[model samples]
Target chain A: MINQIRADMYRLTHSWGFYITLGLVVAYSFLITKSKSVGGIMVNGNQDALTRLSRENWTALDGIRGTTMSSSVLMYVLIGLFVIIIGYEFSQQTYKNTLISGISRFQFITAKYVMLLISILITIAAYFATVIAVSLILGRHVGTSWAHLMSTTGITTIAVAFFISIVFSIAILTLIVTNSVVISSILIVIFPLAVATIHIFADWNWLKYIDFFGVSNDVSLGKLTISQFGPYLLTCAIILVVCIGVSLLTIREKEL
Target chain B: MTETILDFNNVSKKFGRFQALDSVSFEIKRGDVYGLIGENGAGKTTIMKLITKLSPLRHGSISLFGETTGHYQQALKRTGAMIESPAAFGNLTVDQNLKVIAKQNGIQSKNAIDDAISFVGLEKKRKTKAKHLSLGQRQRLGLAFAILPHPDFLILDEPINGLDPSGIIEIRKLLYKLNHERQTTILISSHILSELYQVSTKFGFIHHGKFIKQLTKAELDKEKQSGIRLEVNDVAKAAEVLDNAKIKPFSVSNNHSIFVQTNQLDTGKLSQLLIMNGVELNGMTKQEGSLEQYYTTLLKQTDEGEK
Candidate 1:
């Protein structure tokens, strides 16, 4: 298992796509920091909007939230990265090489998952660093209490982790089912867009609670209450588990 | 008694509506260079895939080194294979690609990788990306991957598909060395019957997903039909003389040549008899059936049977 992971990591790190994707994520974060918007909603420099909100100060928590929220679109980049990494195994038939070398199917899948988790953690860290660097360069000030700052960062971290997990799981499941990088990436993009479109046209308020786009929006706006966050986290967790479970089952039965 | 290295027991496979393999059974004994010959879509690759567990076995069992394929990792640990085509990461250099495989198989020594590269004659191209390699070079890399870790059994499907004549000879020599020097059992498939003829100790002929026949080298050589040809001044007189001697000619050609099929016919006695019968013998040659002719005859027989 450790050998498999090492092999995957070597492949990933040696791939130029990994560095390119990381560069794009950092560039996107920098753009979001400069724009002062979370997905194009003006979160800074709008005194009336800030005063209307409960918190009037532009704190580091807001900076982190803005970066994470804007970088949600980086999910596409993440999916594309994994598509190149994992999809190439099937496309080039390298998976058969691994199998012939005595690596089990279960070990193959577990190694990929381990690599994905590591990539997610690296992406999160890159986003945080970009946000901190940009905020410091722009002389942005934090005026919130330390307790509040820590609590808000903790919640935002959890929300980002949940969202990233969902996207990662979806990427993995799509790659497994389709086995074509282009098709898997197309579906990954379409799934979120389809959900957002339905949420917009549907008149039901409950749609926002179950929609991933809605959840991201709520988290970005800092409007998520304990009640709303709990159910959203639970739903995302379930989707993640199901995607992983289905992938494992499908891969076991999959013909090379 | 030689131990069986690989045994397929009544294996059958289906892909949707097409049956790829039908009750195919064969065995490879230790240190034997087994050749699998078949036409396109003849289930050669399917059988290899089943042994490697690239495709799951649904209706039959495959045993490698006496262990069922259910314990494939343990069984495959002593096996190496290059199926269909050479599989390598296009983005990685040859050395890196080999390193990845070595790490996967838990070989920590760099010398092993170096030795494989040298053995395949790819030492100079080790730093080149796999995508940049010519087809023959990639094939060498695939062989390098298969031979690494010194497996007891090596399964190769068309291992020399894209090689030039010298490249083919190189691979043939390498496989021979591995089999004879290292006592490695090899199961190989190739369309080039002539090349297979040079190294294989046994042969298995498959047609339409069936194991039509399997024969040892000696059995095959014995089964092959041979004939004696005579170039004489007068074919008619030679035929008459052969008839008089109760030795019928199998064929009498327009070029004054007669062919006789009989292992017991002595050339010296025939020449003496022809000379005594006043028939001038210009030249006589004995022709042995080649592997190609043997394979064609086998296929023809199978086709006739189907008809």
Candidate 2:
């Protein structure tokens, strides 16, 4: 398993798609910070139409955490990463080479999951660093202390990392089952919307507990208490386990 | 007393309502180039998949290197395969593609990769991407990947699929070299039976997922009809001399050859008789049956038995 993971890392580093997607994630962070500083998104030629906060009152930590919180937008980047990491193998049928090289289905899928986790960590770090660099260069006020900013941004990074993991786990499971990147990407994009749509139609308070995307929105990392964060973590854990489990099972039965 | 490299015992497979492999069983021993002969959709690839565990085995047992108990990971470590089409990352260069496999196999030596590339005659194309390669080059790339690990056993399905005549001969020699030098046991399937005949030491005939026959090259040679073929100076005179010698069922195939379908023919007696009768005998030898004819005849018998 370790060797498989090592080989995958070598492939990942060599892949143009990985570097391109990482660059996109960083570029997106810069764009988001720049746009947020310019008052907000333009709506019908009005620059302040969606302006809810003033940049003068925001801190560098806020800039970084704010970009991380928009994991909804970041999910698409994760999809691209997943496509490169997992989808390409299935499409090219190259996974058979790995398996026939003595790697088991369990090790193969586990290695891919680990690689996804690594990519999420790297993307999170890059996104955070980009937001910070852009904020400093754009002359945003340091409204918070460095210690406070680091702690809060650290917490938000973890939360966002957890969120991306849950999202890409679904992508991994779907990719393994269907062996189609397009289909897996569709499901990845549609899953949050589907969950949100279901909650809207049912109007059930209990749905919020399962609506990870909705709950993720309310996660103001530094402000949340233990009781509030525990359930989210638990839900993320359950979903990750289920996705990993199902992926392993289905891959074994898949006629490669 | 040779070691068994692979064994399929009463293995069967079904895809929904379609039966792909039906209680099929065969064995490949050490140093044996086992040719798996079957028509299209005759479960050749299915059997390859089963042996490699690409498709899960539901009915019977498959022992690789005498380990049938577990997932065969340890046993598979010493095995290499290129089943179906040659699969590779189109974006990666041939060297990089092979490097990925080398990494997976924990082979830290770059020499192994170079050796495989040169062995498959892809030394000049090592830097070319697999997608940019010709079909024959891709086939060679697949072979290079399979042999990279220096495996004790190899399972190749149509490994010569896209090769030209010379390329086919090169791969054939490569297989022979692998068997002779490395003692690599092989289970190969190809539509080209004559090529298979040139290399394989043993053979398994399959039809409709059933193992119809399993025989060695020598057994196959004996099973096939053999007859004496004589290249004479005068075909008509040879026919007359053979006729006077009470040699029934002799034929003048062309202007200079007479085919005698008799295993009991006295060559010395015939040569003397033909010489005395003014028929110059150039050469005389026994001709073995062709793989195509034997395969066709076997399929016919199998179909008749089914009916």
Candidate 2 structure quality by residue, lDDT tens digits, B1-307: 9898888999989999899999998888898999999999999999988888888889999999989935688998998999988998888899988988988999999999999999999999999989999999999999998999999999999999989999999999999999999989998999999999999999999999899999999999877655789998878777877777788877677887888876787778877888888887899897667887689879999999999
Best by lDDT: 2
TM-score of 1: 0.87
Local accuracy by lDDT, each model: 0.80, 0.82
Model 1: which residue pairs collide? none
Clashing pairs in 2: none
- What fnat does each of the candidate structures reach? 0.85, 0.73
How well does model 2 score by local distance difference test? 0.82
- Model 2 docking category: medium
Q: Over the stretch A160-208, how does candidate 1's per-residue lDDT look in tens digits?
A: 6556657667777888887877777777677656665665676665555
- Per-candidate DockQ vs. reference: 0.73, 0.68
Weakest 10 consecutive residues of candidate 1 chain A by summed lDDT: A40-49
The reply for model 1, stretches above 4 Å from the true place, is A40-58, A142-162, A204-210, A213-230, B229-243, B246-259, B262-286
